[model samples]
Target: MSETPAASVSRRRLLARSGAVGAGIAFSGALTEVFAGTAAARGLGDRGYGPLVPDPNGLLDLPKGFRYRVLSREGDPLRSGEGRVPSNHDGMAAFGGRHGRVHLVRNHENRPTAAIRVPPVEGLTYDPAGAGGCTALTLDADGAVRSERVAIAGTAVNCAGGPTPWGTWLTCEETEDKAGTNGYTKDHGFVFETDPVDPRRTGAVPLTAMGRFQHEAIAVDPRSGAVYETEDAFQRPFGLFYRFLPDRPLGGTGSLRAGGRLQAMRVPGLPDLSSVQEPGARFGGVEWVDVPDPLAAGTPIRLQDFGPRGITHAQKLEGCYWGGRSVYFVSSYARSAEGSAADHFGQIWRYDPAGRWLTLVVVFGPDTGVQLPGESPDNICLAPSGGLMVCEDGGGAQHVYGVTRRGEVYALARNRQNPGTEEEPEWGEFAGVTFSPDGSTMYVNCYTPGTTFAVTGPWAGQPGR
Candidate 1:
């Protein structure tokens, strides 16, 4: 399928007309009175895919004719006859495997202080002190687990990463904690490539050329082999969107280690574009500024280097996906108090390489509740049926929302795991929302109370279509 270009004003108009704006309206120069007429203007009071049917298992709530099967959970014995399944299930990628099977490389976002750890395995670990790594799972055509094993170990905070076109998962470490300070022998914050077909081929090499910041996720451009990375750091020294232009096209393996030039994004004329504008606001004349030192020797790359170069900053840049020849990324949330020009519930940005223009496609207004269309979308996946499945990471009830090509929003699933106590019941956020190669099954992870589920339903009959 071809990419939806930034110049496609028709798509934006369709999104605006489909009530994709949700309860929150677009923010104008003034935040208070910005979305006053948005709900009425778009007639978006009754959005979403009907009502969600409460699950009897109390784990997840879904709409009618939908259900999920628990494929794996923390503490489950590994099929490899080694360690148990690690905790803090995070990002994952599913690939078509041999014999009509599917292989998934899942990330464990465990830190040194975590209770359960990804056991240190010989040749599969990076730092012995780190507990974060990845696991490989093989599922049959019916989505039944055939085998599971530790793919990589001894890493730190394997938060989120993207799949390469050549059939490998690039797991990213979402931390910059220096080695020797936190009992770590080597540096943290680096991306590692894993081969699901052969766990033995999984090396402990770090893609240092991709810069050393709190790397959140990556999306690779198949046409040019350029890797787009996102930083999840939030503070006075925020994160900048990065592009790693490899010296050579990425191939079977070890191509990332060949070294590359790391560059940060700079929108000319809008140097300080806070990304807090209304939905459909387009920014032109985008440029890429070379980072003198991608290694960031003893200095934070975002604050010390890119910040000084006038690189445009984003608030908590998270999941990114390559689809339709364009790279779509998420900025969890931006606010004036957080150094942004205006306050926004969340923002989704699309970068069109063909036009070299960055456009704001989806923007959540000031409604912080999950009952709204979508808020704080973290990990994103493009549906095979031509829509976007976004995992919401927000304060209220967490949900997985579906955004149609025309910008209609619908609730696909909701977190129903209750702790039996009164400590804010629905707190777990959904992560690793990905579809199988054939698009029959969808897999996702619940961050807290870590559990991985395989969801299958009438996806084609969903509202996004």
Candidate 2:
């Protein structure tokens, strides 16, 4: 497969199509009301193809005209004869394939003791002892699974990753474990590239230059080939947003392994992103500090002192994607109760690499209640219909929320499977949200039981399509 650029579009057009302009509104602008107010009062009645109807089979709830097909599930036999499918599906990416098919590279956030692990394929296994890796699934033109196989193996806590312009998935290890910890034979927190089309091209080698830390997700700039990554650290000192400038920008497959420079973002006086409570807060002239120790052999990258200019950090730094010539990242949530500087339900930030400025695009109020329409946004991807599809990792129920340019938020899909008893229902968080290259199908993963679904519906009728 060749390089596949992100779904880039004109910002002005995208905003206009979504009805964000001329109204002094931005994406997710009405999020507060959408959650706090009633459905009819919030104008969601005619939005998002109507409210999601409960699924009869107790799997996934979708709009009246929308239906989902189970692509793969945990414990399922692989077509490649590589044992059963792994668990803890997280981030993923979709690429175009021949004969109207779509190729998906999914992450398995498993540990060393996972019951079912990505089979350690000979050359693809980085460390046979590691249980977390990635699997590639090919879907036919009709959205049926054509083939399934292990793309990479022997990695730990493969949480989330981004797609490269060269049509490959960058699987990130959300860990800082050393070789001695948990029986790991090698240091495991690094980014590895996987080719969905040709596994042979991906040697399962770690991209050491990308830094070793708790990586959540990454988004690659098609223009500069610069990769923006998020760190999902929950403890004190939190996580830092990083940018990797590759030596060979846009150099197709296996180029990131060549080398790169890693740097952390610093906003003059702002240290923790959670402190910013209001939307449209813009910070200009932001600076990047070089990471002295990308390998983190002694100290983690976020903990390393940058001298006089301390590195900026945020709590629960998650989803990231490159679109509209800017890199968008998310801060899932922060709380004073958790040692964070401030509190907020969620925040979506836009960073303009060209201008070296950052803006708080969307900020969800401090609503801890599970009734919020959208909360704890993770694994975000730009919707083909001019907005965004956010995977919810919050409490209560789990949903894939869709945000239009008009800032209307609606539940696109809800998890109907309750792992807990009927009296105490539990819904798994949705992750790895992505649309097919043709924009006909939306692929998302349920993290707990590790189920992947391909949703098809009246996408063209979407508000901003």
TM-score, per-candidate, Cα-based: 0.87, 0.89
* Candidate 2 residue pairs that clash: none
Q: Write the per-residue lDDT of candidate 1 for residues 1-465, one digit (tens) a residue.
A: 001233123333433454443342232222111222222122222234566888888888887777799988888788887788888889999999888899998998888887689988888889999999999899987788999988999999999999998999999998888889689999889999999988777578898998888888999999899999999875655788999999987665888889989999888656444544766677877888888778777788876654544778776788888766578788776656557655555677788888998877676554433354445668887765455678876544678876554455667888887643676344567899998887778899987777899988766553422
Q: How accurate locally, in lDDT, is each candidate?
A: 0.75, 0.81
Best by TM-score: 2
Candidate 1 versus the native: TM-score? 0.87
Lowest lDDT sum, 10 consecutive residues, model 2, at: 1-10
Tens-digit lDDT string for candidate 2 (1-465): 000112112322332453432222114443332222222222223366676788889999988888899999999899999899998888899999999989999999988767688889899999878999999999888888889999999999898899888899999999999998999899989999999998779878999999999998998989898999899885789999999999999999978988989999999899999999877788999998899999999999989989886989998898887766678888887767567898666788888899998988887543223333445677887665555688977555778987665565667888988878889776788999999997778999998788999998877664423
* Candidate with best lDDT: 2
Local error of candidate 1 at residue 380 (angstroms): 0.9
